[model samples]
Target: MTDPKSSRLLDNRWDDAKAAGLSESQLLLYRSNLLGSDKRITNYGGGNTSAKVIEKDPLTGQDVEVLWVKGSGGDVGSIKIDGFATLYQDKLEGLKNIYRGLEFEDEMVGYLPFCTFNLNPRAASIDTPLHAYVPYKHVDHMHPDAIIAIAASKNSKELTKQIYGDEIGWLPWKRPGFELGLWLSKFAKENPTAKGVVLESHGLFTWADTAKDCYLLTLEIINKAIAWFETETEGKAIFGGAVTQSADADKRKAVAAALMPVIRGFIGKSESKVGHFDDQPAVLEFVNSADLRALAALGTSCPDHFLRTKIRPLVLDYDPARDNLDEVLATLEASITAYRAGYAEYYERCKHDNSPAIRDPNAVVYLVPGVGMITFARDKATARISGEFYVNAINVMRGASTVSTYVGLPEQEAFDIEYWLLEEAKLQRMPKPKSLAGRIAFVTGGAGGIGKATAERLIGEGAVVVLADIDEAALKTTEADFAKRYGADVVRGVKLNVTDEAQVLASYIETSVQYGGLDILVSNAGIASSAPIEETTLATWDKNISILATGYFLVSREAFRLFRRQKLGGNVVFVASKNGLAASPNAAAYCTAKAAEIHLARCLALEGAEAGIRVNTVNPDAVLRGSKIWSGEWREQRAASSHLQVDELEEHYRKRSMLKLNVFPEDIAEAIYFLASDASSKSTGNIINVDAGNAVSFPR
Candidate 1:
């Protein structure tokens, strides 16, 4: 039964556990195992699962019982009842707002012993407080891999709306523990009929009068998600695909046996082993896919899978045409190092002083060249479930390709999600102080509203921002205002000509040394010189190229070198105008340079992606900054020469954009931040328009 059940057996186990009359040990094991079934279901034990038991309370006036919940390191699948700490139900409910004086990192430790008298051998699930707050008999907290896959995607809430369509109530991603539970209790109170509440990016919660209903509801909800995804993406299988070779039953069994121990180690089961790669055509095809390792390059379906899948799959790079163990070993070692480095970087990016950093991968999948896929989990159950999620994610992405290219979340957004406090709280430990924190990002043309606003947002997110412009007086005046707003370390003022390569390079070095490293480079320095095609001259072209094209390259090159040497992925933003995309009348040279810089940014985006470095360009249409070319006097002079009024000049340009709102530097910065963060790991070589829908007219 388990063999055929594979990943689906989890649903059955939950049902069977309840009917069989669970032992104290069996009950704890059942809850833990269920929680471990999905990485998203419980990450580093981010979620909590509990069972009610009858017991005597000495101080109680009437007879009452308690609940035993999973404690620290007592992974759900293997957890014993002894691993569960008991807390009196009434006392647990009475202890409200116990988190006031406790540090978030230590909150788990401080609260565990206070709520339970049995002295749990492990730390209580952080959400124990929330579980106690609710009136339900059974409560389960799971990140629910399927749920997060939908949540972390672009406009996930809207996607959920399209999928579930009022089937579930969705909440924004928030810091978990006390607040998360409180939020849920309040929400549950408001919506009395919700079957389950979907916590965006966090996970899902379900409850019922009986454990069977709750367990079935878990499947029903996830299956609803599965069905919704299927209906919306009709005929697109998340995992099923074509295979290049026929399955050899003998070879399959041998492979499964060889992988059993490793698989069991991962999912925490011994008899569990690899199964069904033989039954699935896509699994076979994926193993045979060209550059299977490269295909595995996609990040996990969800972040917690990073704990199991170890961030990516091991590419079988094995030569089906010939045997190559040395090459395989070399590739394996390289993969190990790369994975470790990524973990290290994540640790440094969001680590907290009190928590120990994640030092090793908890799970991995092997992608052999000719052979099919093999995944490792603490037990066979986890491995099988994770494999399904991976296979499904790959298929969905590939199928989505048929409809249109898959565009990932913007980089900066990915960074924000990956490093978000709520998500970070799910982990047992976090990274130390951010290595990139306090670093200053100097953006030229900072007096421009977009540049200024980008600086402001980055400062607020914890990075120091330096505003630089050729307008020395404006720089100094703006510097004073920002310094007052963000404090001395968070804001800086620099007056340098980005057009001067020496000055740009000097400033880059000085800024790096001053802040320990340059975290962001916003090359917004440019001048626009408009001329009719007939009157265009070599001199006019040189001037535009000098500032917009050449200067941007020089500054970016210096920043890249510094970042590369430091081995930290720094972000770079280029401020090009929409003229780069569609030509406007009498602006040939300016448009050409802006277009060239735009192309340069694309090259950086692709080349810099692997190093964690990012580069993006913003093209705003009608930024009314005081450029000598776009100044009122200059416009009036040109309009008089053309026998047109000044108002006509403004109308002509304003009407060019669809929305007719003048584009500003702030608009550009919003897109720039999206490209700069880790949230956009899969996004690069993309251009975002800040022109109030002007790009729609570009003949797409």
Candidate 2:
């Protein structure tokens, strides 16, 4: 049992906000953070809060009321003052009249924008009117998981009454719109003593004259629901035991390695976009449970989840222990076909004329019973958000099942929200994503200067990148740094000695399992060896050939196998040097290895042409800045050979180029990105020289 005193402790912490004499808007912001900071209260951008404050109307020189509400797409936990959209109260209240007669589409396009008070252009949340209609000075709305468990239960009405008695108004599952707002407003008027309103199949709403009171009431009500659920479900066998002891790590990875690419290929056939995949522990637990099919078939825990997870997750028939890869993939294909057919029928049964065009029938979340759950989206961020919500939904549904039967919104109600104009507009409002939004990229030598730069560039363009390098320490540091910028899901690090065939093959398999498949492979790993033919030791030549020549072959071979299996065209980029095209004196081993690497790329290009795979090479010359090849004794020898000081070598290289520009790591990175992207789609078996203007090294 949660201590009731714990609720008091939280309330006491808010006394500091009151002591600071915060303005109404500031208090609302502070409390919004307080509510949003707790995942139990809201997840991601799931909730909104508002404050009614009196402000001077600049044009009229009179004090008028304004509703400051959480702006669209703004998370309450991190919202600043500007994150709140300000609206003229009198103007917005008048919208209720126009809303009554206007169609939902018309209201979204015409009326919502006209009611704004401030010059800020962010669209107010769709739930704006719900806050405007409420008479409280402070109102908070949250989709607390605990409350959702109760609100989505079959016995929600009776449960609501038992929990809050007449102090709370229970509104049935009505599609959120002008009508719903009006109904809630009317209910508050009739039930004047009610402290909050519970929207069935939705969430909770609490209000008070002060932000502190409103916040405390929300926590109080949510705690009540939690206590009730804990008491009711105690000793109940709600969750089934695991179907089998969790598979060993290698087995789980092998299952993902075999299944994710095929699933990705199947889904990609329906849409010509990049795909994303995730396999978190929560997903594994839920999917591996014996009751997965029974629980998942019941649909999403709430209507709002449909926006992220869809109506139902597609459950594939997969048993890691008994099923072979080919059999699992075939079964998955048939399951997807059946899912589409069922989705089309469901749409026909529920869709109205105003409904938006049907979205693709592919399920966002796929449950592979023995392996885990994999979520698909157009980008990594959305896939992760969908995964997070599904995990929460699973927990809520499990709790609801333990107490009373779990019940989601009816199909028509889900359709009404899923295709709602306001919801669709919110998605349309987002800025266009980068060109490589859902693509996966693998960079060898990723801990080195050029490789790190290329990985960062790919991530900036929105590709999920896997950084593989023999240097484990550097690889870990680079991964951690990239995670700080993009997120852990955006960049993964793998220790890879590219010359080791087993490690090379395992890296590709891991990439396929983690991100469905690879689209771009930058084979940039190599070692620099400079020696005259007579003086060159066998060790020098062998080491250079092993990493520079043989490493490229190993990694590329694995990449080719996976690309052929996926049947999706991919890009391969070889990072050769200008010396490869025009040899430098005393650089026999290095030049020979690079020349071999370049030729290997052309051969792969010819072999991959039929599969639509494009192979290219980037030859960068005198890349002194951040170039590991130009460090230590090699720098002295190269400078001595050119009869220049160590520091002057960079200037010499700069002047040597026709453009007289210093070639930095980023310059090489740009060339690699161009070749990897669709910009060079028509060009393959091509070499891009990043040597400024190397007339001698320029491709014929």
RMSD of 1: 24.0
TM-score of each: 0.45, 0.93
Alpha-carbon error at 468 in model 2, in Å? 2.4
TM-score: model 1 vs. ground truth: 0.45
Off by over 4 Å in 2: 1-21, 101-109, 239-245, 270-282
Global Cα RMSD, each model: 24.0, 2.8
lDDT of 2 at 320: 68
lDDT of 1 by residue, 224-262 (tens): 655445445567533334333533654444333333222
- Tell me the tens digit of each residue's lDDT in model 2 across 1-700: 2456544222324667363878888999989998988777887788899999999887888999999999888889989999999989999888766554435534643576787885768778777878888888998889887788888889888889988899777988866666766777898888889998888878898999988888888888888787777778778765575784456668777777777777677777644334344456766777887778888877775665768888899887766677566776767778888898998888899888877788888888887765666787887677777877787788678777778888876777787778777677767878887867778999999988899999999899889999999889989999999999888888889999998999998998788766778889999986786667899899999888999989999988888887777777889999999988997898899889999999999999999999989999999988877766777678888888888899899999989899999898999999999999878999899999999898888776
Best by TM-score: 2
lDDT of 2 at 425: 74
